[model samples]
Target: MQQEKMNRSLTLIPVVLFGFSFMALATVFSTYGVAAEISHGMVSGSYLLALIVMLFTAYSYGQMAKAVPSAGSAYAYTQKSISPYVGFMVGWAVLMDYLFIPMVNYLLFGIFFSAAFPAVPSYVWILGMLLLVTIVNVKGIKLATVANAFISLFSLLFILIFIGLSAKDILGGAGTGTIFNLEPFYNPEESFSYVVAGAALLCFSFLGFDSATAFAEETINPKKTIPRAVIIITLVGGAIFMTVSYFAHNVWPDYTTFTNADAASHEIITSVGGKTLASMFLAVYFVTVFGSAMSSQASASRVLFAMGRDGQLPKFFGKLHHKYQTPINNILLISVVSLLSLFLSLTLVASFINFGAFIAFISVNIAVIAYYFIRKKERSFKGTILYLILPSIGAILDLWLLLNLDIHSKVLGSIWFALGLIYLFFLTKGFKQRPPELHLGAAESS
Candidate 1:
């Protein structure tokens, strides 16, 4: 019997939910302190700047999704438009994002869950989350998407509550005590470099929008839906991040006074709503992280499936479940790898994930230029501006962010790339020919 294929059952709303969940509605709480410190309390401005940079990249992803609606995402875009060799390397780089992000999400869940229930080991929570996400993914895309949508809605509710409480506290003569203030956007003490550095880190919250493209093969009317979803998710997610960060900044205007820079939002939560609400916020935050992990695992499995089907990795990774029509092997692989969170430090894992994401962002931006301008010679003024000039700017911004990564991340990312190089050597038989290709069905170019 022939193996089952992924069900083309996902629509625009589910896609949007998947993207939103992957971005994680609770992201501000986890990263706000660091962003505030880096930008000298200009956390809102940093997120806005990062959103601008991400929008440009989102355009490239949108254009590419229309051009090549395949599950490989950046890999498919690069392979079809640029060289297959480059595509393989891009796929390798993106694998780091897909493979490790879920781990990060689960690691975060573990930490918070363990905190809530101190008697339980963190690793136990991690394992339990891993199991739940894996099972949801294996069941099918629709189930996973529904789970994400529900979790996303609850997460959004909690965020709105947090913002409302913060606003009320501000009105009650706390911190700035007024929503109208430019202090969160700028301060004389903060330099341009500091804001840019903060923006680089803030970009992490926007990472999941691109992963939406990985569902191309499983989306209904993918060429149109995936592109629109990519842009919409970015805009929506950016709005949430910016608004929350703005109020959060108002609640605690002094970055230097944070007891733990990494846990600044914790203090803000307690101040705004007391310990009970803070505890409730933590529980909701865990749910959001769980949603994030589920979305990440689903996306990562599809990328592995795409790569496997194209013969970049073992063909087994390409196989869909006989009954469920999901990427069973690849999903299982990701679950196994996510176990690394048990042993790895959160700081190292998060930094390395960002490194891979930045590299992949650079590749996707360049792929837009190479394919549309250089290869196709579609030099119409609009095409030139959108496909060439915009992506160039995105690439430059991504490069700047890449430079801002810590040395440890830079080194580890380099090592991952080196391993990819070694794998490519054997896969291509010493670079004598192109890598194997998978036939994508019914791709419509925009």
Candidate 2:
């Protein structure tokens, strides 16, 4: 078999630009903000805090991505740094994260599409969008990458315009008192514990930063480029999201209004401006969500394909097109799963998928801790505290959120995770034999 290598057409643009559009950004910030509005406010402040946390959290991944440059992201890093079992679990965790997230993105699109044009059933649009994206992804990576870039670029332009128009409206005295109220943080009425739990909801929204690591095999000068992409995408995407949150809060002001509009056209966007501006914003929303859905599908399929090639999944899943060098079978599988997910209730699909993400976040954090200790790479107590202790706390916090998920989502998420565990056991039993390693250095010297 040929060695695993990626075609290096991907640049920082695909890594950064594509996933930052309004549909994705809006869904993330608005969802978190809406939840916070019901539970509390200062979601804008919390978003800023998340950015800060991500900056520090991202540094370790940046270093590791350069050092390893593998396809499966945390799954690859944790395995090399620890053991294959750890790798297997990490892969299982992320497979859910990658799989469900696209479904969430597409479901959100279905919601908005149904709202924008009330004649069509939301589920139809959801399934249709999922099908179209799946077809696009199955064609090839190069095509998907190029499409992501163009769609993201257009989406970015519309978002900027939306923000500008919203800012002007706020300045013109059409804004509400909640726009200036930072009272949510100090308010006696808010539940602090739920707010902490609510932070988990925001966790998945900031996920695209890892796209760099996922695309590592495809990048030229991966060591230099991958780290740069990881850091830049995190900071830049964080900045844009923070700014979008700021504008969204300023325009809608009372976060509760968004939640009240739940499963409907978010009044937050409609409340922003004139029909011309609204039309422009709606157009922006279209591409923004479409890009996020597409990006998620593309990234998730690659992870599945890698695992399959390692004999940890169905053998047919490992097949790639000879000419395109793309994982055709894997992409098709992802597309089918995504379409199935979309046809179900959006809320139902989101419930099942959300915990996969929480578990992933928890698993990766713990893996970083385990890797450090197992390797004894650094012996200092302080280093241990910094890497292991903090991430453990993070993992614990994530698990708490997972546990607290509403009964419906929690039950579904558990079933899905259980299926993954069963699949993992079969793979482990089937491929118990170890493979030999090659040393290019020794061969060259000899």
Which prediction has the highest lDDT against the true structure? 1
Model 1 C-alpha RMSD vs. true structure (Å) is 1.6
lDDT agreement of model 2 with the native: 0.64
All candidates: TM-score: 0.96, 0.84
Candidate 2, residues 1-446, lDDT tens digits: the string is: 55544577766666555445312554543464454554465555555555655555465566556556666777776666666766666677777777777777777777777988999988788777777787777776677777777776665676687677777787777654334555433345665654454455555567777655777666666667777877787777666765666666666656555546352224555677556756766676676677777777777777776676666666676577777877778777777787765457777776766666666566666666666655545448877776676666666766776686788877877787677767666656655743222111211111
TM-score, prediction 1 = 0.96
Pick out the ten consecutive residues of candidate 2 with the lowest summed lDDT: 437-446
Which 10 residues in a row give candidate 1 its minimum summed lDDT? 437-446
RMSD values for the candidates in order, in angstroms, are 1.6, 4.1
What is residue 155's positional error in candidate 2, in angstroms? 3.1
lDDT of 1 by residue, 1-446 (tens): 34235778989999999999898878878899988888888888888898899999999999888888999899898888888998899899999888999999888888878877999999999999899999999999878877987898888888889888888888999998788998787777668777777888888889899989999988989989998999999999888888998998888888899999978888889988899888888778877888889888988898899888877899888898988889999899899999999999998887678788888889889989988999888799998898899999999989988897889889999999999999999999999978986566556473
Runs off by more than 4 Å, candidate 1 = 1-4, 444-446
lDDT of each: 0.87, 0.64
